[model samples]
Target: SAAKKTRTMTTQSSLKDAFSSYADDLNHLNDKREKVVKASRDITANSKKVIFQVHRISKSNKEEVLEKAHKDLAAVVDQYVARLVKELRGSDFWKLRRAYSPGIQEYVEAATLCRFCKSGTLLNLEEMNASLSSLSDPSHKPLQINILDYILGLADLTGELMRLAIGRISDGELEYAQKICTFVREIHRELTLLVPRMDEPYDMKTKMETMLQSVMKIENACFGVHVRKSEYNPLLGSGDPSYPLMGVAGGIDL
Candidate 1:
C-alpha cells in the first residue's frame, strides 16, 4: 500500500534482511565447525594408538615407528581435507562462503613428513649433553621451559644422561644432569597427574586412525580375520611403497 506521500523507503526492512542473512551464514559456519571437530576427534584416536603401539616396541625401532606414524598422519589428513573440499562443491554450500573451504587447509599444509627425520638421528643423549655444555653458560640465569622448547632440548638432555650413565662419569655434568633429571621428572609428573584434555578436537590424529581402520575393515571383509600389517611401512617417500632400502635398526633390515 502506497502510504500518504511515501517517505523514501525506510532502511529498517533492509537491515532485517541483512540480519537474517547473517544468521544463516552463522549457522552454515557452525555446520563446518562441527565437521572439523568430528574429524579432529577421529585423528586424535589415531595419534594415541600410534603412540601406544610404537612405545611398546624395542627402543631400536623408534625411527621406523615414528616415520610410519608421520606418513599415516599425512595421508589421513590429506584424505580428510579432500572430503571437506568435496563438500564445498555442493549447491547448499554455495551461498555460505567466507574464506576457509570447509576449514582444514592450514592443518593439511602443516602436517608434512620431515625428511631429516628419516636419518637415524635419534634425538638421543649425546647431542643433548653437547648442547647443554654449549648453552650451559647461562649459570647466572636459569633456562626457561615450554613444551616445544622442552622437546627441542631433548637431544642434549639425552646426551647428558648417556654420558652420566654410560661413561660412568656424572661429575662435570652434575648440574646438567640435575637439569635433565628435573625436566624428565616434571614431564612424568604432569603425565601422571593431569587428565587427557578431551576438550579441543585432536586434529589429523583421528583421520590417521580412520585410514588404518579402513585397512582392518578391508582385511576383515576379505580374509575373515584382521590381516592388516602390524609393522609400519618405512619406505615412506613418494613413488613405490618400497621400504627405504638403506639402513636397518639393530639387525632388522627395515
Candidate 2:
C-alpha cells in the first residue's frame, strides 16, 4: 500500500510540471501573436499610404509620384515588415500565417503596383521575397511571402487598376486606359485557372469574382472612350476630341 501511494504522488507531480510548461508556452504564443498583430496593422496602414501615393500618378507627374511611392514602400519594408520578420524568426511560418497574412497581402499589392506603374510589368513573388531577404538572418530560414498570399494580393490589385484606368480615361489618356484593360484581363484569365487549386479557395473565388468586375469596368471604360472618339471623329476629321472623357464621371463609380 505504501509503494502504491508513493507512485501516485510521483505521477501527480509530473502532471503538474507538464501543465506548467503548457501554460508557459500558451502565454508566450499569445504574446508573440499580439505583437505580430500590432506590427501587421502598422504594415497595412503604411502599405495603404503607398497605394494612395501611387494613385496620384499623372502623365506630368508620373516620375515624381513613383519616386515618392518607392520611398514610402521601402519604409514599410524597413519598419513594419522588419518587425514582423523579427517576430517570426525561428518560428514556424505556417503556424502564425493567419496572424500576419492580411498585412503581407497588402504589402504585396502596394509593392507590385509601384513596380508595374514604373515598368509596365508584373512583379513576381520571387522578386518580392528577394527584397525582404535582406531583413532576414542568414542563419535562419527567411520569412518569404508564400505564393498564396502573393496571388491574393495580386487579386486585390485589379480593383486599384480599375480605379487608375478610370482616372486615366478622365485625363484624356485613352491609350493608357486600354493598356490597363489588357493587363487586368490577363490577370483575371490567369487567376481563373488557379483559384480552385489555392489553399483558400473560397477567398480566392470571391476575389476572382471581384477581379472579374474590375476587368469589366476597365473594358467598359475603354469601350466608352472608343465610342466617344468615333462620335467626335467626323466633326473634327482626324483631330483630337476637345473632351474625350465627357460624362465619364457620371458613369464610373470608382
Candidate 3:
C-alpha cells in the first residue's frame, strides 16, 4: 500500500510538471503574438504616413514628393515591418494575417502608388515581396505580402486617385485628371468581380463600396471639367491669376 501510494504521488507530480511546462510555452506564444500585434500597429501607422507623403505629390513637385515618400516607406519596412518578420513564423504568417494585414495592405498601397507615379505601371506583388526579403533572417522564410492584402490595398488606391484627380483638375491638368478617372474606373470594374470570390469577403466588400465611391468621384470631377471646359478655356487663355476654375472643382464626399 505504501509503494502504490508513492507511485500515484509520482504520477501526479509528473502530470503537474507537464502542465507547468505547457503553461509556460503557451505564455511564451502569447507574448510573441502580442509583440507581433504591436509591431503590426507600428507598421500600419508608419505606412499611413508614407501614403500621406505620396499624396503630397503634385505636378510641380513630383520628384521632391516621391523622394520623401520613398524614404518614409523605406523606414517603415526597416523599423516596423522587420519586427513583424522576426516575430512571425511560416505558420504564423497566415494565422496572424488579419492582425498584420492592414499594415501590409497600406504598405502595398504606398509602394504601388509610388511605382505608378514613377513608371506609369503596376508594381507586381512578387517584386514588392522580393524587396522585403532582405529584411528577414537568412534561416527563416521571408514574409511575403499575400494576394488578398495586395488586392485590398489596390482597392484603397482608387480613393487616393480620386483625390489626385480633383487636385489635377484644380491645377489645370485636365488630361491627367481624365487619365486618373480611367485608371480608377478600370480598378473598380475588376474588383467588382474579384471581391465576391475572396476567402474572407467582409473586408473586401466594405472596400468595394468605397472603391465605387472613388470611381464616381473621379468621374464627377471629369464630368465637371468637361462641362466647364468652354468657360475655363477663355480664363486660361487670358492667364487669370484668380483661377476661377478652382472654385468649380468640387470636393469628393469620401
Which candidate do you rate higher for lDDT, 1 or 3? 3
- Taking the tens digit of each residue's C-alpha lDDT, what string does model 1 give over 196-252? 332222432343244334333332332321122112332233444332222233234
1 versus 3: better TM-score goes to: 3
- Which clashing pairs does model 3 show? none
Residue 42 of model 1, lDDT score: 51
TM-score for each predicted model, relative to the true structure: 0.34, 0.93, 0.85
- Candidate 1 wrong stretches, greater than 4 Å: 1-9, 60-64, 81-254
Cα lDDT tens digits for candidate 2, 1-254: 99999999999999999999999999999999888888889999999999999999876789999999999999999999999999988888889999999999999999999988998899989998888899988998888999999999999999999999998877767777778889989999998999889997999998988999999988888787777668877766766544443443433455
Pairing residues by index, what is the TM-score of model 3? 0.85
Give lDDT per model, in order: 0.36, 0.89, 0.81
TM-score of 2: 0.93
How many steric overlaps does candidate 2 have? 0
Q: Write the per-residue lDDT of candidate 3 for residues 34-82, one digit (tens) a residue.
A: 8887888898788888888877877678899989988888898898888
| RMSD (Å) of each candidate, 1 decimal | 18.7, 4.1, 5.3
Which sequence of candidate numbers ranks them by lDDT, best first?
2, 3, 1
